[model samples]
Target: MQARAAQDLKARMTDALVEAGLTYAGAVAHHTPRRLVLSVQGLLDQSPTLREERKGPRVDAPEKAVEGFLRGAGIDRSQLQERDDKKGRVYFAVIEHPGRPAAEIIAETLENVVRNFPWPKSMRWGAGSLKWVRPLHSILCILTADSGEAQVVPLDIDGIKAGDTTYGHRFMAPDGFAVTSYDDYTAKMRRARVMLDADERAGHIWQEAQNIAFSQGLEVVEDKGLLAEVAGLVEWPVTLMGEIDEEFLDLPPEVLQTSMKEHQKFFSVRNVQNGDSAGGIVRFITVANIETPDHGATILAGNQKVLSARLADAKFFWENDLRIVRDKGLTGMAEGLSDVTFHRKLGSQADRVARITALAREIAPMVGAKPDLAAEAAQICKADLQSEMVGEFPELQGVMGRYYAQAAGHDDGVPEACEMHYKPLGPGDTVPTEPVSVAVALADKIDTLTGFWAIDEKPTGSKDPYALRRAALGVIRLVLANGLRVELASTLVRPYHQNIRAALERHGAIPAEELNLPELSFDKVGLVERYQESKEGGTEDVPAVDDLLAFFHDRLKVHLRDEGIRHDVIDACLAMDGNDDLTLLVKRAEALAEFLKTDDGENLLQGFKRANNILTQAEEKDGVEYSFGADVKFAEVEEERALFDALKAADGAIKPAMEAEDFAAAMAAMAALRPAVDAFFEAVQVNAENPVVRRNRLNLLGQIRGICLAVADLTRVEG
Candidate 1:
């Protein structure tokens, strides 16, 4: 809490100072359980005086406008100077403001920081209407000069006035001390048995804990987060390691760790040789505020007694859960999920599991998994949610399920899936490598995205309560990492359509007279048949598969942006056929992205743009498209004849490469026509004097546009 307080204070104070126009060279903030401190170095004494001229109405404007301008600028007519304006001569009012001392700004900024500090939650004390993380214990406000003179800034808020004195640790040194500078204050704090720096205190705890644990041939579990939190709980940290009770040692190591950490703010000390076994961790460590007379032996005993009681409760929960696992297996443990509501709009956890199971079964063969194994894994992965162990320790949800699955005589792949299906929870997390885990994992995330999108609950702006973006990223990693050739749109279209129907029926979005489910179309742009007349003659409810596909494309763009693929490049590929096949779309995008980096590709793009622009204008003006064969005989110039031959040759190469989905080869073939295109543009006048030649040249430009677009829509590829 103190660390968080320190961080909050630093950011808030910095913002306040900057807002108050008091820029500084450097600033640092520190906190302990009792207080927060901030020090600024080389802060400007005052904001610089601002001076500028305010423009007014034109010199020849009406008298009313001149009066309003004088009033707005706070100037008399005599003070206005004539200046040339866009329309006519305008009056300019000279404006000047003087700077104030930094001390004055600091006082006001500090008061605002104190009264309006965002403490997450705060409270009022005495009769004052002020709230803080705690009571505004004491305020240490000072300004030290290079001449060794220190002055206290006048600040009083909510009965707490500014002072030069602050007390150290409440128990060790309760006396207050006056300080002339930040350096003097910190030196006194260290001597008074208080460490003002949170990192310093945390480092002391961790280093001492390791040294002591090493003395006993055991190692403390490294938890930097827990260390930081524990450091915040005390002013002067005294690290102590305690032994666990022999009776409670038989409990699961995770149960032991969770019980100690959650209930007592303790760290587990593990015997490395016996790792993962029940008795692997035989000791626990705790940080105390003050050093005891017996060198922490008494503190160790008291903490161990409390830890034993906590572990006893954990052991009871563990054994009871183990009995259920052995007798009924993971399947029986998860039966309670039917009664648990996953969402009010969606169905129960059991309902989601069924959907995932069915989806996994369908997706298994595509990802190289046996359908039966993938189906079984999905059924049992979430079983731990119903276990008593997980009920007490929710962080161990997937972890405990793995243990129970193993106990239920399931194969390694099934148990592995039980724990690994939630892999790659974020971008930094690892994607599961096992084929069954991959299949089940993809199914789980895809079902989440599809189910929520069906209900139109997709994330907007920054709000993603369902973590749909992470799920989409997880799906991307699962596909790309494994090189799976799955069509994400086809995979999403069917189940997503079903889910849309279910969600629509559940939400009552459709007309009550009768349900009219539209046919799904995967061979084209949309997943659902759109623009259908309602039974009563309006619009009907159908899956928003196209919108959802676009959403996935947006996510995929974000995922690939770091790889140097531009959004316009992805948009160009998305505009083409087979965009539903994400693997194919990305493959084409990656190839096109690389190709566009070359001189040949760049020139070809310019040529294609030239052809497209002319064709678009000509078609709109003539009210007819020039998308047909170009006759070489009609070409009056050698450049036009050479382009015709280049077009035919490029057509032969791009056709087979595109047919085979070899985008690189097709892009290369298309690029080879750049010289022919450049030569034609340089030599031939496209709008020739003769009508036949003009018509033939327009058709040739049309062929250039058509052939290049066949590779990837170059119209969307930005210059």
Candidate 2:
């Protein structure tokens, strides 16, 4: 945020300079929490004079038009110049602007930038019109020349004036000092016990903390985000390490770490040799902005007291939650979820959990997981949402679930699945590889997507209130990363039907049976009947399942775009049969993506396009498709006969290869036809004078289109 403030200053300053007809080479900034310092480099002393010519009405045009031109130009008719033109003659006016001094321009620019600065939050004080993130303290603006002469730019806003003096380290160096240049200002700031660079302050804090921890056998858990934030909060950092009280040491390491990091802004320290299982979190490192005579002994004492109190609360929550889990198990605790509304339109959290449980069992066999295990894992995965520990730290929802599951004596991947099912919370997060975890994870995300889509709550233009996009991407990653061959068109149907049925039952004025809605079931055979029937009837009662599938396709394109696979290539694969199978779709896209990079594939694309163009035009003209009856005996040239033989061979190889989902082999077969197709187009005229010969060549071109499309829709592939 400090860096963004500096950038905002630079951009506004640059715009002001442009408005004043002045220019600067560049800008440099050093931002601290309390101050933003920017230096404009290589600025012109004054703006250049501008000369412009303005065109006017024809000389012989209406008198009113001529008068209006002169009035708009702020010039007299005598100042106009007559110029010869094709349409007789025209009038022109010359306009010139005088230059303004750089000092004058800088003053106006700085004042405007300060007055209109964009802050995430700002306040006004002392009945002043000026608003700032903090109180307006001082302004230091100076222009240094090559000869070592410096002059302060004239600026004043709301009783604050620009000067060459600046104060540092509010408490330590309360006195103001003068500076002549940027280098001199920074050097003096260092002497005042102020660090001008945030990165330098962070580096100092980390290195000192590590050195202190290394003297013992402990290491600080690295959190760059916390480091940067702590760095921004201090102008001069002093590192101090403290030991946690022994009473709270036996608590979960995450509980200890989260308590310290969240409440005290301290970094957790753990024994490097013993790890979490043995040593646990024994210490914490804190950064203070000032050094006392006792070397932070007084500061550490106060912080330790506050930390112990916070950890005491955490310990109570943890013990209380564990006791509840031991007495009732996760299921008994999850009974409260029925009271928690997941969404007003789509029933409660318990209803959603039911849909996910059924979906997980249905998807278990496909992902190599036992139906009972997957269903059980899904049933209790979200049970900890009601726990006191999770209520205190919302980020530890799944993490706490894992611990409670273990306490409940659930095994066979159930304990791990409680935590791992929410795996891949982001793009950089790891994907779960366990079969039971994959089934539950896929079920969780699919239910979320289908539920929102059923309620007509689809994301629109930078607004996804439901996080549906992230859920869709999660589904895509789970399917592709696990190599799960899920036909999503059918997998999505059962949950979508359930989501619709549940929503209707909750809020519908009419019963579902009155509207001809079928009962929601997990029957594997013809599972898509409910979803498909609604779509085929073109009713607004339920959203199209294909629309949700297409959303997954959209996310897949974004997911593969970083792998250098083009959108059109994924579109080509998407246009083919069985596009609902994300694994197969990506495999074909990857193969075709690699093929299009090779010489054979590139040339084959051109040949296929050429044949398709000719065949389409002929079909349009003849009012019939030339898809069959291309007899080898009717070939009028050797090139035509050779092309027919190549198509036949490619078809023979590609059919079986595509059936086996061996996309590489199918693409290779398609590449073999490039040479024959190219040679035939070169030797034989597709639009021959003889009708029978022309029809035969058109049918042969149709053969090229058919065989090439068998691998992927070449028409969707762009050059």
Candidate 3:
């Protein structure tokens, strides 16, 4: 995160400074909580004076256009000269800009950067029109030459003026002092209890936290994000360790940790003797701004006092929730979900839960989970969303459900399923391996994809408000990691039909107009009510199950794009059958991707494209397809006859290879045809004088297309 932010700051400040007329070799931007500092090196005393040629509109063009150009360039009719151009004679002007001192340029640039800083949010302070993210503070601008002589760059903004003096460590060393140069300023700040660099502060905070936890035989729960945030809050870092009361320790470790980190910006200390995070968290650590004579004891005590109150509330919620879970059961906790809308048209969370439960039950056997166990996991997986513990901490929604499920005396794996179903929240997140977890996880993601697809709420470009891309990738990783052989299109149809019916009942019509798929028989969708009896089945051909299936291919394409398999390769395989079975599709894509990188594959692709091009033009010109009945008798050249023999051999080898899903073997078979195809293209001409012979050669080319496509759809693979 800091890396990207630093890069953006460097680029923005560089461009802004250059535009403001400061000349330098380069500039680097460093960020801390209190400041964004740009250290520019190899700076000239002043920007180089520029002599530029400016142009005006054509001489015969509109008067207003020429006048506007002149006015914008700050030139007059006397300064303009006539020049010859393609359209006509045009007016040109020479402009001279005298350079200003680097200090003056820098001061002006800094003022503008501060005044109109591109913060996502800013505020006006003390009635000034200029806005800033924070209140006005001192500006310390300086310019130094190679000889080591330094001058304080003059700047004055909103009544605050630049000076050689800057204060440090708001509490510990708040007094201001003067300095001569960058080196002097940093050394002074360090001595005054301020760590000038954010990284240094972060290192000190983390090392101290770890040491404090280690002395107590526990480890600091590593939250890089929380560490970075807390590091920004102080300059003189004082890491303080505090204890959680024994009563609150009975609450889930996640609860205790999350409460401390979220509310108080403290890091949790965990006793992970078994090398699992599930090992309970035992204590907490917070930071102080300064050191005291009595050390951090007073600070730790005050922090614990505040932390205990927060944990007391959490304990109350946990106990009350466990009581609700035991008395009312998971279903009782989930009762409020029916009223909570998941989407306006897709019904409530209760409706979504019911759909997920159905899908999970159907998917359980395929993923090696017991149907009953998968069904039970899916039913109550989201029950904690209604719990007070989850209400207070939404980030722990699935996690708290696991605790509640265990407390309710459900099966051991059921609780794990509740927590792990949301596994792999992102690219770096882990995919769950347990069967019940896999079943519920797949069901949950698949339902989201199909439901949104049914409503035509598919992601467009970068705007995936639903994070359907992550959902699809999650499904892909889960299936591939577990080696599940589920066909996605057939799997998604039941839920798609359910969504269509639900939407129809709610809004009285199927949203066929919004879907960009095959034909949808919206008027006849009523027939889906008697799904078993419906002759055509409840599925629509338009925006058919195939369309949503296409969406998964796109998501899968994004997921595998960085794995060296090109988009065209994924697209080629997506064009084939069983593309809905992502594992098979990806395997084919990977093999084909590897093949295309080889000499044999490259030659084969060219040969195939050449054959396809000839065949396509012939069929279009003749208004007839010359499909695969190429006869060796009509082949007038050895090359054509050799291709005929190769096609037969390839056709024989490719079929069984594809049947076994051995794409590497199939591609090898196809690759053997490349020599014959290249020789044929070189020797044989498809548009022969004899119409019969011409038809035979075109058909031979068609055979090449057919053979190549048999491995994977090579037509979609670009040259």
Q: For this target, which candidate reaches the highest TM-score against the unseen true structure?
A: 2
Q: After superposing candidate 3, which stretches have Cα over 4 Å from the reference?
A: 1-10, 53-94, 273-278, 455-462, 498-544, 690-692
Cα lDDT of model 2 by residue, 142-238, tens digit: 8888677889998888889999999988888879999998888999998888997888999999999999988997888888989999998888999
Clash pairs of candidate 1?
Answer: 45-102
Better of 2 and 3 by lDDT: 2
Better model by TM-score: candidate 1 vs candidate 3: 3
What digit string (tens of lDDT, one per residue) describes model 3 on residues 369-443?
Answer: 998899899999999999999899999989998988998888848999999998779888999999999999988
- The C-alpha local distance difference test score for the whole of candidate 2 amounts to 0.86
Instruction: Show the lowest summed lDDT stretch of 10 residues, model 2.
Output: 518-527
Q: Whose TM-score is higher: candidate 1's or candidate 2's?
A: 2
* Per-residue lDDT over 1-719 for candidate 1, one digit per residue giving the tens place of the 0 to 100 score: 56567777778877888876778889898888887888888888788888878888888889999999889988788888998878889889998778888778888888877787777788887898888867777888998988878889988887788988888878888998999998998999998999988889999999999999889778888888899899888889998888888998777787788888889999999886555422477899999999767999988888888887777778887788889988888889889999999877678999889878877877788888998999999999899999888888998888888888888889959988988899888877888989899989988998888778766788989999999889888888888888787767655554455544544574575444444554322223222222221223444444476777777788789988977799999899999987778788889999999999999998999999998999899899999999996899898878888999999999999999998989999999999999999999999889888878888899999999999999999999999
Sort by lDDT, best first: 2, 1, 3
| CA lDDT of each prediction against the hidden true structure | 0.83, 0.86, 0.81
Candidate 2: the clashing residue pairs are: none
Best by lDDT: 2
